[model samples]
Target: MAWSRDEIARRIASDIPDGWTVNIGVGIPTLVPRYIPQGREVVFHSENGILGMVPLREDESPDPEVIDAGKNAVSIRFGGSFFDSSVSFAMIRGGHIDLGIVGALQVSQNGDLSNWSTNERMIGGIGGAADVCSGVKQLWVAMMHTAENGTRKLLTDCTFPLTAVSVVCRVYSDLAVLERDERKWKVVTLSPGTDLLEVRNATGFPIDI
Candidate 1:
């Protein structure tokens, strides 16, 4: 059984503690808030300027002016507060957020991340990853295990420019849920159809699933 993307989001959401302030990054990171049940008392912060964002509207149109750090159109929710980019970033840098969920293109065994840029020269951006990775106590990375060409993103070491060094705590992907153990990655849950050996072959890093 493959790990459905929505199931991955729900699993990540379950890990979020009640009363926590979470910073959801671009990509699948945004799906976390949707899985968080109402009355959970979780406060969401976006890098652009919204703190306390509600779950995305089911049928509402995207707003041109309101956007996230990724510049995706967003809707404002009640109890949501808007601030300047500097102030919002200050909240992340000042360690106000408890948990951060970010999407990654690659992650090293020591928890280094590279999500902003691919091999392509023109579309790279580091943005707020460094700040969030270093500042937050808990960081969760979500992405596919392998590239379309079948190259693994979980590596013994990263080839791309790193966003932050040794900052990730856990990873959720189409394949499994993994955690960094000292200098190696430990697989916690195997995806339905995946076996341990197959995952081991995919990731060059030494892993005990």
Candidate 2:
């Protein structure tokens, strides 16, 4: 079976190196903190100026004020700090973030990111995505392998608006984990019981083993 949203989040969380400062984006990326391997010490940063972010427990009430970039209520871990949006973006642009986990609408074989649009379902702007993609020391993407219409999201070339070019280091999809090696995307891991053919068929672009 394919990895569920939580499973995918867990897989990525377990792989984060200890003591690294990570800036997480919206969507499935928000589900990561709760699943970070216990005992690992990673600082989570949110674009809207919150650091040391923890997902609000279901039992917790919304603070309205303390939230992540997606505007989801989040709890700040002890010693966490808040800054203005400009300062938060400064940290990203200063190349202090070790890794960024972001969602995608499509990813090209060349590792371009397409996350924003001009139409409905859009945020009406790129909203810090460009900074996150361009400024992070390493950028990785989390998304489903296919679009809602069953279209391949791993494409020969992204058809939607691009967020950044050649910025992605890896992609964690529902079906597989892909690592970028120069011009090729290596299938690093597959979901249990999933075959390479299924992944290949699901990808719009050619991938390497």
Candidate 3:
């Protein structure tokens, strides 16, 4: 069985440390704020120009004027600070963020990331990905383990354009929790009904489970 979305959220939440500033990229990374524990003093930064943002209400968009990196409408929470894009990049490049959660298209064995684009589909710009990957203390990549056709996304090497090389420290996918060891990716936790060999077979690499 594949890991549920809540399980993936918990795995990402477990890695967050108290009082650390975090920047979450678009997609599944947005879910991290929902599972943060109480009194942890976590400040979430948005490249769309907000810091210390609280999770927006799911029912209604609080402020049509306010939004996140993904351009999703949001509301400002008490104690949240707002800044322009230049200032946001400064914070990212200055190493003020402790951890970043990002979605990826492909990840190599050595932890290279390629989430910026899909060769066949021209979406939008790469945004602040390059800056965040290089500046954050640690990076957590979140995505499904396989493509829609069941092709492996985590591999011995990434074929998509590289976003950052050797920057990913951990991964949270629908199939398992993975960590990078030396030049190899290790399966730290397999999904229910998935054994060690099954993970290795799906990874298409020498994964240490």
Candidate 4:
């Protein structure tokens, strides 16, 4: 059984420390704000220039100007502040963000990330990923274990253009949670119905259980 996108978001939320300023990247990472555990206060920093983001409301009309890096309309907490993109990137590059949650195309055992584009075509601009990866104190990736074509994404080397090298500290996929140390990748947790053997088979590189 594969973890749903919400489940992956929930898993990632559990790992985020309370009181930390977090920058949620586009895609699955944007879902993380909704799953943050109760009793914890996390200040969400959007690359598009909003901080203290709350969950987006469906019933309520959205504010066009209030959006995340993905351009998805969002709500903010009581004390939220808005600024220009330059100020936002400054916050990211200044090393003020504690954690950065990003979606990745591929990650190597050595913690390299390649989420920007594929070799076949350019999907979109790299955006602030390069800065977020290098600026945050810790970087966590949330993505599918395999591509739509069933190609393994956790590999010995990323075929896509590198976004940041040796920057990923952890990965949360539908199949498993992996952590990287200086030398190797380790399986921290496996999704329900998945075993060490299954994870090993899916990944292109070896992972310690």
Best by TM-score: 4
For model 3, give the 10-residue run with minimal summed lDDT: 117-126
Q: Each candidate: what lDDT? A: 0.84, 0.90, 0.84, 0.91
**Candidate 1 TM-score over all chains jointly:** 0.90
Return the TM-score for candidate 3, rounded to 2 decimals. 0.92
- Cα lDDT for residue 133, model 4? 98
Candidate 1's residue-wise lDDT over 3-77, tens digit each? 777888988888788999999988888888889876787888988889887655769887788877777777766
Off by over 4 Å in 2: 58-60, 118-124
The C-alpha stretches of model 3 lying farther than 4 A from their native spots are 58-61
Predicted candidate 4 versus true structure: per-residue lDDT over 144-200, tens digit per residue: 999989899999989999999899999999999999997588999999999999889
Q: Which has the higher lDDT value, candidate number 1 or candidate number 2?
A: 2
Backbone clashes under 3 angstroms, per model: 2, 0, 0, 0
Candidate 2 differs from the real structure by a C-alpha RMSD in angstroms, to one decimal, of 1.5
Which residue pairs show backbone clashes in model 2?
none
lDDT of 2 by residue, 124-202 (tens): 5799999999999999899999987998888888888889999999999999999997668889999988889999999
Report how far off residue 77 is in candidate 3 (Å): 3.1
Candidate 2 lDDT trough over 10 residues, lowest sum: 116-125
Q: After TM-score superposition, what is the CA distance of residue 42 in candidate 3 from its true location, in Å?
A: 1.4
